[model samples]
Target: MFAGAQVSLYPMADGFVGVILESLSALDPYRDQLRIETDDISTLIVGPPEVLFPALRDLYCAASASGHHLVLRTTLSRGCPGEPDDPICDTSCLANPSEPLAQRQANALETLRLAPDMGQVADAQFSLYVMGNGDHMAEIMGCIDFLKQSGTFYKSKHFCTRLTGDAGAVFATLQQAFCQFGPANGHVTIDLTVSANSPSKR
Candidate 1:
């Protein structure tokens, strides 16, 4: 029932400090809904899936608005056995594991369709980890199928999948993958890197 993410933002510009500090304001509206702590390394956001992903999207969008190359590295997790459950992390957005995989995929795709466009483009890659036993590969493969049809899927990589499109849809796809592909109450995590306005593209 607990969900959270460790996020670090990198702005590939001379005024990186200013960009990072200013973009943090994007999380202001979410402060009441999430537990956020920032230090030298990364910012930790603890909250429900509903709020967590949007907060990340807003933060990235705010920074990318500077027209500088920006990268966000995030590790998102839920139902970690090692972490104590907190009421603030409670959410009803998770898929029921007992539900059929096809139904879950359909639900995920529908959700992506409704995702709002954040007016920014993003290129991202991530690996979803479904911890604990019980047909993990089936769940992962099912998630892969969902990604391909997500409209943001770019391709498959060695150990992860690549996604590109509007920031909103991309992040929504990630949220669905995190929530729907694993056991309803099992530990699940994602390692993700998102980029915008990269000079390498030019």
Candidate 2:
């Protein structure tokens, strides 16, 4: 029951320090919501998906707005097997003292709502490994259908489906799939990977 990501941000421009610093600064507001660690190579963020995705959305949007070439690559996962238990694994945030499921879905939906139609901005891709369901195949297919209709998913793969179109729509579709099919009992898990690159200014 753990969710985390390792991210590398590359801003392609002369003396890119300002852009990099600006992007890192964007995470400051999200510090309380995420478990963040940065070093020489990349930054690591760990927390609930409800909190993590929006932080990514805001951070990336701000970074890409620099009018400089930038690439943000990430590996995100939840309920991963053999991942050691940590504070980020806490389930307390999944539910409220009151109507837990409703609140959880609402929080998850917020992430999707923040997604921007990156179609005019960037072309990106992400992968999801949806796990732990008896009717998983049907649910998975439904998710694929949902993505296809959204015009964000490009093709289906064996282990992961490749996504396309606007970065925001792609992310929105991904989050929507997880929120709709993700387990309510905490028995299911999903592993995700995202790459935001290739400016659509083509």
lDDT by residue (1-202, candidate 1, tens digit) is 7899999999999999999999999999999999999999999999999999999999999999999998999999999999999999888899987899999999999998789988999999999999998989999999999999999999999999999999999999999999999998999999999999998989
lDDT of 2 by residue, 36-122 (tens): 998888788888766676677667777777877777777766666667667764654343323443444455455455566653344
Best by TM-score: 1
TM-score on alpha carbons, each prediction: 0.99, 0.69
Candidate 1 global lDDT? 0.95
What are the Cα lDDT values of the candidates? Answer: 0.95, 0.63
Candidate 2: C-alpha lDDT: 0.63
**Which stretch of 10 consecutive residues in model 2 shows the poorest summed lDDT?**
92-101
